[model samples]
Target: MDLKRLNYFITIVNNKSYSKAAEKLHISQPSLSNAVKKLEHEVGAPLLERSTRKFALTDAGELLYTRATIMLSQMDIMNKEMKEVIVGGKGEVVLGIIDSLKTWLPKLIYNYKQSYPAMVFKLFDVLSVEHVKQTLQTYKSHAIITNQLIYEEDIDSIPLYKERLVAVLPQEHPLSKKTTLSLADLEQESFIISTEGFQTRIDIINAFKEEQLKLNIQFEIDRFETAVSLVRNHLGVTIVSENYVMEPIDKTVIRRPIDHPFLERTVYLAYMKNRHLPVAIQQFLQSVEEHFSTNKPL
Candidate 1:
């Protein structure tokens, strides 16, 4: 099969619909359909089972889909390598980071750029751990800086740092008087918590259970800022990573680490283990390690 047809096949699998893939590639639907048909004929098997309701890939199609993803990625890497030979290692670096990580990332990116003047750095705030894992799996990002580790067969992680979870309470709350309170002390206390799917949520919940305490979740918010804001208004308390507790401290909000469970979140730099990273990204990784080793953010 032609490389064009293979590229089209990868797009179709990614979009999950021939029509949607056609629209994205700016090609006519009939032309895209013909390409897939010819590909199926050449393979002597149907790649996609088309039904009135939805598209499903057959077993052979699923295998081909996985292999095609890697093949296309390798081809793209080869093309970039050829270009880099002429232009040097000066391509864009796409980094996916957890939303809460923005606090100190500016410093890291600044240091990286000073060292590698030619590479353009693009930072994207990925909201969830699963999203970062998906980006790594699909070659959407060169690297991910995140607080949570997601289990994926193809991805590898480098340990970066640990972030402790601190309790945010209104300055007037009775719990604010304690320098450090036990998780058991917060049992039945009203809390503004992040939604349940987050791995951080799981960590907090497990910690509470270990302390024989039950969390009374008053509100479920998606953003870390929302949870902090609510606690500032005296709505309830919330558990948040230390990196998120930036100051000029709101006079109304007080932060204290929980002493009983003593929970801390680990941050990792994730990338596809087998994927060949561009030279610019390799230099960036080195700079990141150097920045974190000596500098402690204020």
Candidate 2:
């Protein structure tokens, strides 16, 4: 019923022991028990079941715990926002980024710090695009940058840039001499494609499916570097974003743009549609936009 009861319930559920929860909350065990009892009474269902050896949540308890976790997080955010507003000198922003963006985001984050000097940044390197979307919805990250975008109706996406997909091929491959190649050129070659769960792999699959083409995959890899390495060793050809294959590419390998051509993946800066970005976060976003605009990677 009250925030105190909800907090007590959550702590007890998380710790899974009345005595441990009481110690963590700095309250007496009896008080903790009474608070949990009051919560269960208000909800009209038993929240926890205890045996001699262990404790576990009932179905109702599981649902309540999930709801309470989200509520507690919102409360924590509200408290932090109030404290920051009162203090007037400190702020924090969390950014979830894909691995491909890691090469450029560090410099952008560093520039943001130089300008603000008091803002704190929390960066999470995420592999899944869906996970990035979930993170934004849960308020875990204020914004996300990724080459692949999921067209969610409730999310606002800003077009950062379109990155050209390039082919990494072994030195002796006949098409390696070309300046650019198309997906059709890959028909003769066995591809070293990204694994099925990756966003890039999904995009590649969908794009090929649209053209009624199926990839002849020799191997599937999880990381861009791994795929590229296989190509370097004359294993197979790979298609990846240009940013991922910067200088010092292997001597046995050659890179060429996909010009003959499929659609270039448009990278986006995505955030929740109705969310109010804090001043520091807005500044950081602006800085990222400016960086890409000014430094056109050819």
User: Which candidate ranks first by TM-score, i.e. highest?
Assistant: 1
RMSD of each: 3.6, 4.4
Task: In candidate 1, list every pair of residues with a backbone clash.
Answer: none
Task: Give the per-residue lDDT digits (tens) of candidate 2, residues 1-298.
Answer: 6998999998888888899999999999999998888888999998988654678898999999999899888887677556656644377777877656756777777777787888887777666767867887776777888765768887878888877677888888899778878777887688888775576787677777777778898898867878888888888898888777766676788888775345467888888887666676777888777777886553
Off by over 4 Å in 1: 7-37, 44-70, 73-89, 99-103, 150-153, 293-298
Q: How many backbone clashes does candidate 1 have?
A: 0
* Candidate 2 TM-score, C-alpha based: 0.74
| Error at 116, model 1, angstroms | 3.0
lDDT of each: 0.80, 0.78
The TM-score values for the models, in the order shown, are: 0.80, 0.74
Tens digits of per-residue lDDT for model 1 on 79-117? 755665565566778898765676777777777778677
